[model samples]
Target: MAPAVVVIDSGENQEFEGKITVYVIVCVILAAFGGLMFGYDVGISERKHVLKNNYCKYKNQSLQLFTSCLYLAALIASFIASKVCSKAGRKHTMQTASNFSLLGVVLTSAGVNLEMIIFGRIFLGFGIGFAIQAVPLFLSEIAPARIRGALNITICETPTSLIERNKMEKGVKVLRKIRGVENVDNEFDSIVHACEMARQVKDPFRKLMKPVSRPPLVIAICLQVFQQFTGINAIMFYAPVLFLTVGFGNDAALLSSVIIGLVNVFSTMVSVYLVDRTGRRLLLLEAWEAILVVIMVCIFVMGFAWSWGPLGWLIPSETFPLETRSAGFAFAVSSNMFFTFVIAQAFLSMLCHMQAGIFFFFAAWIIIMGVFTWFLVPETKGVPVDSMLDKVWKQHWFWRTYMADDDCTTVVKVV
Candidate 1:
């Protein structure tokens, strides 16, 4: 066998400055507003009485519908967001989502009836779905490969914004702005190469069904399902109720919930530093699954915050080939929203029937998630999106399996 020929343009070998510019930081901060809006909407349900007070004559069911309606709208929007992003560009998609969210906010604030509130909620959901789909995709495309993982996690977990679009020219500009990326043309050419390869396949969805695309897709969807089924949302939704059950008063329970919220924010910040340094696979495999299961609820959240908290958004953005990236992310995001709805709706009932068994049920799922991560998820630290498909295909049956140099010469021998 011969060595593979790799070409490097003369200008591509220059050293990077290794400093993040204010422009890059500002863009990331702006893109992260979507996450802030998402958190606010999810948390605002706890204060539905404000809506009830404004409307004066609403039933309990109507209020429930108002609170949960955004998820439903998001479900519908998720299906179309990728298509829109692909056609209009990521920046436009985000702007459109922002418009939708702004309109929803205005309508909800000035609503005189149930119909107005419902429409407002639906619009807000539509915007959130689009923002959720586009933000990470944009961030991943624009970031420098060295710190891309950290940037994606930071933007997902913190308040970061996006650049303009996915076009090679704009992408190159964004990359040039990042520290340690002295040769923007080479990186831009790589993106072009990926896009060219993607162009050969006429149908993105059909391409995704092929062998090379299947593993990443499976890993992505499975991680999403596991993330939701682990009962994070259930605990988040009913923290007060759980506290009451555990012998705390209403005031204490509410205070406990506030403390949990603070923990969530802090943990998310911690993940920003760890994601790039420790790598996504190690964090998911070792941090959560191997250790932290003692304190039950609090510990579980810590594990989740470290592992799935950022990787859930980071991995799917990087896993898919350029051709199928948009559609693939759409599928993953929609699956996340769907399962979130299912778990949020079913958790209380399961708690009622199972009592102390609910935590055990979630524990079982978390164990399965750990096993899946060890076997299927590959280490993607410092890997480029263009080469991710090849990386996935080169892995052993179990991702952690090790082979000697002689055994790993060719694809066939490795398999």
Candidate 2:
């Protein structure tokens, strides 16, 4: 009998040498500041009352508009993020985001009129959108296949480090330093392949709209929409107000909001630990979707934090093919920001008009989201970034399962 050759996937669990280097740690920390900025912008609305008090000229309606304008600008700017990243590279894009955020902070702080503040918020929003797209992409590009999912999760919650940027040699060196990366050759080759594919594609926009790209893009956009429709932005924007409705004092309500924020941060940490081990599909599908539309704003926030909070950023980054990755992410983030704007602009009014019925509305949407996830959303744990497109194409778009017999094959049965 002829001896069989065993095929070992690069993404399979493997041991590595050395501790995670300080250099890698520093890169992760710095890249994570993007997530910090994202959280800061989202949470700042919690103190909108303080802003209103400081600027007495701002009316309630005006304050609402001011609070949501950032999302509006982000929605518009997300469309441009892919083009910018494709040209400038991920690191430079993040730096650009940081610069815009800094300028926005300064302008908003110094603004004497509504227009100036709004303009500042626009800058802030644009920065956020770019950061949302670039940070995860950068991290995924640099990390090893075994721990790539974990690293991606960490970046999503904390958020990128070095690699790519026309420097494959440097990227390979960086990859070797990360924990669990035994051999950098396969990872490096994949990155090179992805880069080459990206370069060869004549029109990325048309390429992204092709049949093979449709399923992943649909899943990505759906996840983004469902994330927002789960009423995360509503709770984030109006936590105290929502608390007050249940008879809590102003102080207590604000305190409740603080607790929720703490829970969000804590749960995100837990997600980072669980994401790789448990796999993306299980963590996401089994998370608290049913309670998403609960009347208690605190409960909604907790559910969101425990479930979609981290995955919102994770799934979109992982879904698309290499050539269209940036654009796919840009589309996903734009969907997120677009829905964010919708919820932010309409929540209070929805409360005024629909009262608690709005919760039911969100509940219905969450049900749809759950169904979509069950049927779609592959388990991306341990899958190499460059292989994601091939993976997407091999499986049935709506009905497929990851098989234990082989890491790369998907079991598809026609109904």
Candidate 3:
């Protein structure tokens, strides 16, 4: 029998030793550009293409499709990204995403017809699709656990790219270099163990369906769903529209909405410094929303920025073992984009029908999100990615029951 290389439950002694290099910081910042690109696509498609651009002339439903197809394309592309992340590696996959965005930009910029606009949106969707899935995984793997949430969560910002691949010796060397340490024996060993186990599984998607993998998968999907159900997209996607309802003039509404977006970015920057210090669960619990005026909108944006927007991507990134990191994130990203599309399509109508009640509608979901986080979500503050199942999930009160038999999952294969 080949020896089973197990990543034991983390304890104080398990901490990896290293200084986070400036090079790693720079790589994380680059990889985080995916966040910027994703925001740009989601924001610009609505603000520029559907509303501002003259070439988007169409009926209301067609215009809605025009706005939505990008997310639809993104939902489909995430699956494709899983394969690419496994084969091409995270850095190369991010480059490919940028290429798609560039092509989208070219088509949209020169578009004289609706088809060109749709094609452009589709391409941009593919760019962000591949980007959100790969970038978070890359950041989590490369960053030190102490600040992994800070670094990985930052990728939800304006835009970024990434580093490292899968060759064991080379991966270790790169890991040590980025960590600015002479020895990375312990950290690298855990990663190797995870990869070895990953190799025994032929289908990551099917494996994800098993009860053993339920905790991380559940957390990933629920966080994504809750992130959107908070109606941050409504506030984000239609801040200007919502502003207009509150009696701001069109110009003032646009300006105020822009302020809300800026706050979103600024608050996420704050999370980069706070997540590791405070831990992940508290950040989610701290979230709240308000809907009074422009000032209140900015406050709401600030709350979401620190909590779900970035943490949605951040938590899912760190939770998955490298074996299923790529594939698992693909589902998380798809859920996010799908719900985002849902909110985008439904918000205007919800606003029309619910009027002042829309705020109450989103408020109800926030209550449930808090309860869910308190009872079910495991803290991944400084846990190593490979040891997450054993250290975090298997130790949680609710999740521990589901993960009780998780130990038997080790698969043996000849090296």
Candidate 4:
């Protein structure tokens, strides 16, 4: 059998062995730029909503539709990104996504009407779709297995870092209990041997490494689908409108919208820090459950509640395995986009026409997401990427059992 390779490697061990090359950090930072742009573009759209609401057309429903258009295009893009990335490699796929984003920016900047605006939005979605799906997959692939969950989780978290050494002290007895060949003594010796082998290595990173696992196309697809459908996009798509309803002026609403973007980025960073130390379950529960309550209250308030604005920052990111990570993420994003188009474009407007009924609709949706995460989502932080699949596939009635049971979850087993 082939050795299962984990993606993450801690910077600590590499200190004497030679520093983590600048190339790796550069790659991660560049990928993060895609995320940054995604945030900026979304913010720009939200600001435009405020501008239109104050100046042109006064709360135009078409603006929301135009924004929704990008997501629509993205739904198409995400479906293809997986296979493309698998074949083309991460760097190439990201470059393609960047080109689309540039196209969208130019088009939207020059757009004169709704159709032109929609065109720009579509291109933007194309870029975002590619970036969103490809970036995380790249992170998971390159990161060390021991820290895969933390690194993968950080791709969404603004970006963040560990303990456990005493175990080495008791290593012999533990290894004996686990058993091995007659000549083998303990894990400590094995670890020391491995370290010595690495130390004698002339150039570790320079060595050509074989592919350890297939790209996580499936997981990316699932993530994008779930994220979008879960009502996150709906919230973002109509943030200004929500704030306006709560008595904030156009400028105030736009400013708050920017704040919301920053918060999303900030909270992502927080998640990165917590994922490794605290594990994935606690963070998901804290985040989604908190969002659930605030969104429900916003529903009750019949206006854009300031309290609910911060809830967007509480999204979870560790519910996926490395193999399926890409597909899962893409899936969540696409679903969110699909619903953002449907809900924000069709339903939200209708609800607004009713004046007091719209809040209830969003409230209900947020609550459903909270319930799903709290009960069904598994904790994935610090999990080995390859082994994650084993645990996930082991359950005979995985979906049915988890969906039906109020208290059931899984975390990766460390061997």
Best by TM-score: 3
CA-only RMSD, every prediction:
10.3, 10.1, 8.8, 14.3
Q: Provide backbone clash counts, one per model.
A: 10, 1, 11, 53
Least accurate stretch of 10 residues (summed lDDT) in model 1?
2-11
Q: How accurate is candidate 2 locally (lDDT)?
A: 0.65
lDDT of each: 0.64, 0.65, 0.71, 0.48
Candidate 2 runs further than 4 Å off: 1-22, 49-59, 152-190, 276-296, 389-393, 397-415
Off by over 4 Å in 3: 1-6, 9-13, 46-59, 153-166, 185-190, 276-292, 406-415
- Candidate 1, residues 1-415, lDDT tens digits: the string is 1101112222122222345556556667678677776777765654442322312122244555665678778878987998888777777788888999999999988989999988998899899899989888877765645566666523221111121133545455545555334554543454454454456667878766755567667877887888887787776666666665654555655666666666666777777778802899875764453223213556667777777877888888876655677888888888888887677556656776788899889889988988888877888776655444344445556431333333222211000
TM-score of each: 0.77, 0.78, 0.85, 0.61
**What ranking emerges by lDDT with the best candidate at the front?**
3, 2, 1, 4
lDDT score at residue 203, model 3, on the 0-100 scale: 90
Tens-digit per-residue lDDT, 266-285, candidate 4: 55555454440267998677
Best-to-worst ranking by TM-score: 3, 2, 1, 4
Query: What TM-score should be assigned to candidate 4?
Result: 0.61
Q: Taking the tens digit of each residue's C-alpha lDDT, what string does model 2 give over 214-301?
A: 7667878888899999887787777766655544556766776777787777766666677702789875653433223223455566
Better of 1 and 2 by lDDT: 2
**Tens-digit lDDT track of model 3 for 1-415:** 1111225534332455677678778888888888888777656644642243222122255566776788888999999998998877777788889999999999988999989989998998999899987888777766767777787632221101111234666666675677677776765665566555667778988878877778889999999999999888777766666655555556766676777778888888888877702677764443322234766777778888888878888888877665567788899999998988888776776777778898999999999999999888878776656566666776888877776454434621110
